[model samples]
Target: MPKLTSQQQYNIEQVAATMAIEDMPLTERAYKHLVQQATGEKTADQIAEEIKKEYQNG
Candidate 1:
């Protein structure tokens, strides 16, 4: 994998430090697809909804 540039690292760190966990949502299609592959049996929307529900209930 390519190394992250200093600016990219800083930006990621800033977001990580300031962003609320609940505010994050599954917006990346590629990641949703990966979730499908990892789980072996679920649509992306299903996965996203399940995550949203779990986070909301916590």
Candidate 2:
């Protein structure tokens, strides 16, 4: 949605490269969230509703 600065782009690339061979929890979390936003069909309201349900259930 927004443009990454050159340094930010390089940092992501570096994290991705490390993730290719091993587990990087924070990076993995960030990557999963990024991919979810990139491909998701749900709106922010929908996601928030889901979270609300989860919290209510728990």
Candidate 3:
């Protein structure tokens, strides 16, 4: 994965902190994957489908 800028890294860290307190929290690694998917070339629909497939299989 490409390196994130300082601001980007800080933003993701903040998001990670927020999600940590949620009822169903994702690991930091999972949040990193999410950031990657959101910034990647695929359309939103494609990303959504990928998440859905993973959820079903998981």
**TM-score, cand. 2:** 0.41
| lDDT to native, each model | 0.56, 0.60, 0.70
Per-residue lDDT over 1-58 for candidate 1, one digit per residue giving the tens place of the 0 to 100 score: 2355676556555554554475664345534444454445666677778878989999
Q: How well does candidate 2 score on lDDT at residue 39?
A: 48
**Number of clashes recorded per candidate:** 0, 0, 0
lDDT of 3 by residue, 1-58 (tens): 6666787677777777787767557775567576675456455577678879989999
Output the lDDT of residue 46, model 1: 77
Ranking by TM-score: 3, 2, 1
Top lDDT hit: 3
Q: Residues 1-58, candidate 2, lDDT per residue (tens digit)?
A: 4455676566667767777768654455466444444445445566667768989999
Evaluated at residue 8, the lDDT of candidate 3 is: 67
lDDT of 2 at 22: 82
TM-score of each: 0.35, 0.41, 0.58
lDDT comparing candidate 1 with the true structure:
0.56
Candidate 1's C-alpha runs over 4 A off are: 1-40
